[model samples]
Target: MSHEIEIHADGTAAFVSANTPGWHRLGVVAPGPMTVPEALKLGQLADWNVRMEPLVAAVAGSKCLECSKPLGDKHDDMCVTGDHEGQDDSRIVDEHDTTHAVEVPNNRAVVRTHPVTGLPEVLSVGGLDYTPISNEEMGQTLQAILDQSGAIVDTAGSLRGGLDTFITARLPKGIMVGGADPVELNLAGFNYFRPGKSSEFLITPVRVVCANTQAAALYNFRSRYTVRHSPNAPQRIIEAREALKITFDYRDAFADEAEKMIKAELTIKEFERLCREIWPAPDPEANSAVKDRDDALTGTLMQIFKGETNENIKGKKTRGTHWSGYQTVVEYLDHHAPVRGEDADSGRIRAERALVGKARDTKELAFNLFQVA
Candidate 1:
């Protein structure tokens, strides 16, 4: 069996091995735990375009369209140098207002196929966000804050938290869509939880390939904490992640009938195993399992929650969902999008390291991976 194994930055591996001769392909396993978003992205890109660059999406414009500067660097602080590569928010000084236009370059990275395999190698020439943090600084508490509060936390089984929890809080208080307020957004404590008010709990935090919401949060929370929990603990993050994973699997496994080759008979046992692997059975008899919570907002978080849907994403129309508590948090962070301003020919803005509550005004919603042909 000919196989190609690729190691992702998150310590996960993608092994493409052949089965039943070269024609039949089998097994797309994610051995290690990564973020839920990472897994979902990988799964989607599996058969989609091999030419998209997710790493580039990771950073807004790692590569400069004007001077061809390599855009992405480590997460802390990346720069295009050489006059910002005409990158956005760049300016050209004029002695007498003589049209000193330093073309606000379209921070878009180039997508190219792998040179050797003839496959794609979505290279993100310059999608580096913020600045680089020194080992010393990373050990500080603020960095911990950044990690915990991403835009929309990942949901893969690998971790406890997703970006959704921390995206908005990572930035200054005043930033957001339609200029909403953070406290009004009311995203303080845990979701679907009151923490400490519940039962005795324990969870081993793992930044897995498929993370649940709590896992997503723990991934960030660990930065601030000392001794971490065990993998054996009842992790709500895992519970949420698995639930969503099952949904994704169900959706894709049944995407289209005529599209693919056969491997047709998916057994009940196999389906059950997938489910078990994805989520923990919620005391199955617990009535609270299916009930959605009411998220009426009166606190600081509520105001922002009310604003998340002023714009739309993939046509989901998040603003209209009126999911209450769940949505209120989204509104708080929507204001912090890394925007440049109007007059920008390219409707592009660098994605912030924090959670992305809303990307309505930006050019395109970024994909998590790069497609290298």
Candidate 2:
């Protein structure tokens, strides 16, 4: 598949083109297992473990757990039955709707407190814009959907929530778990098993990377062995202090190489064409970043920084609020104090250092084996 990524000479990341054609993507958002929260933040943040396609599934069901819904699956992954064709399932059921088991919409949405960050965020599930409200409020009129997805990673030590580690296992499509009930797994166990404090569900989310292939397999192996991230002071920064400090579902190495491959694969002209497609402008690729007026899209990245001066960039011109969104990230890393461990670089992160961490951690920490595959 075609892709677009930017890598620096130092093997660091620049950015991965989310608009590349023929590129399969697995978006591993870094906020909450709650789809709504992650999606909301995705529309705001940067330096996340971006992929070509969503690979994980939000686990559901209780007891001898059965397969349920999946957040990221190919269109043909599964199918559901409905009443008459072209009619809403409810209408058929209403023969007072003889209808039953209708196909659900894909673009799901939601916003909720994360297991760790606790910061409220928007999540993207099945389709993209799923609502966080219970299906009962909309579906069962009293039912709710509580699901989360990602690879299973063990906890570092322990914590509250009776969950120290957890996994985001996938269930059969449409299946769900409503409240705090227990579920069991066969060989793999539930995708997300919040066992108890100190050991619970953890997701090693692999993005657009195809797990069926050798590359993805190698990636998972590395995740099992890599040293975990250690957070310093300022624990109150956000609920994600511990959550974001994790290293799983290795996309670090793949993201790194992919970024370089994307840049090298595209010439300056190709890059321009892609920008136009994904983020088009009237005069794309003009000699100067700005054409005639001082619109956000036209202005130079430098000009935006100069005018905004590290202020938040609204999505209006920057698209995805690139300016201010990126600025927020820069500020986030800027406030990150030095590390006290032997694993990560023992330095404070800043504008450049933040991205440096991003590059190193994306696929490296996610899946890269100390020994090359």
Candidate 3:
């Protein structure tokens, strides 16, 4: 009997037995804990058609079943090339193939004829085993982390297109430095089926008052955790939680460090020197194009210094100190970095990484320059 996988809006999924007509929940399977076949059997839906709803719809990208090629456009309606061109006419051809003249599903690529049935068979690019890290699993993991850390969920939701999702939580109260508001923790996940990329989970830190979110850095005692879907993926999630715990333990230290940086003072000349060091001018021997690029970057730095950028540092005392300088660079990086893609989700990730990396580098520079103790 045929079976069907039913995905719910809450991110949970269940398998429905065609014959028995009952819903069976598919439990979380750690990476490498079981092969796809094993997972299918365990779910008792080995032959069931797996259907991921809007949440993971991007997972439908085409992957070559024979060559193990990476998934192509999830919404691609037509095959790029004919799978069978000069093959025997007796072989079954997909209907979508005008050249071969056979009937097949429009959404699938024809693999080959079924050995026994002699009928054209089609498969998705990811094949049957490329099960994604379900939204349900992601939600559960986020909740688990919050519970372990005694954090309360402040907000949670999935982005449009279901390509990305995030959960924000407020860390336990009373862990404040001076008069600073409580820190907020954000955990986000993405599903991208392209080559050289896999589903990923990320963690970041946000200032409660300012709502400024930055990439977690090692110096902050918090390194961003990325969990990829792999055979050992379940272990990775566990590792991520442990890493988060370590970061939580050092929250006080991180806040203290941040406060120190904010209070540190710098002269105008010192701030200029810091910017020069962080973004050096082109060498004398460099070509005009390179020089032009350097000049543009320098101009951006100057704009930040002149308060022309969107990074709001209004309450900050403009003592021309390292704090102001640091804020200027961060605002520039966070709000002005050029993104290369049209996809807003991908662009946001790139921008966040750039901001975090630049902030980390600037902090190191400050430390070396004696701007921060």
RMSD of each: 24.5, 24.2, 14.4
Backbone clash numbers for all candidates listed: 94, 86, 9
Q: How well is each residue in 1-373 modelled by candidate 3, as lDDT tens digits?
A: 1112334345444321212222222434333222223333433223322232211222222343333334331212233433456764332223233222233322223132322234433322342323445444554565666667665444332222223333444555434432443555554444333223465545555556655564434443444566664556567777776776666655566556556655676666777777787777678999999998887777776777766332333444543555457656766665665555555444455444543445545544543453366
Q: For each candidate, what is the lDDT?
A: 0.25, 0.26, 0.47
If the candidates were sorted by their TM-score against the true structure, best first, what order would they fall in?
3, 2, 1
The better-scoring model by TM-score among 1 and 2 is 2
Model 1, span 188-284: residue lDDT tens: 1111111122211112121111111111121112111111112222343334323322332221221121112111232334323332332234454
Per-residue C-alpha lDDT of model 2 across residues 235-293, encoded as one tens digit per residue? 22222223323432233443443333322322334333333442346566675535553
The TM-score that candidate 2 achieves is 0.18
**Residue 188 deviation, candidate 2, in Å?**
24
Report how far off residue 115 is in candidate 1 (Å). 6.3
Q: Model 1, residue 285: displacement in angstroms?
A: 56
For model 2, the run of ten residues with the poorest summed lDDT: 186-195
The C-alpha TM-scores of every prediction are 0.16, 0.18, 0.55
**lDDT winner:** 3
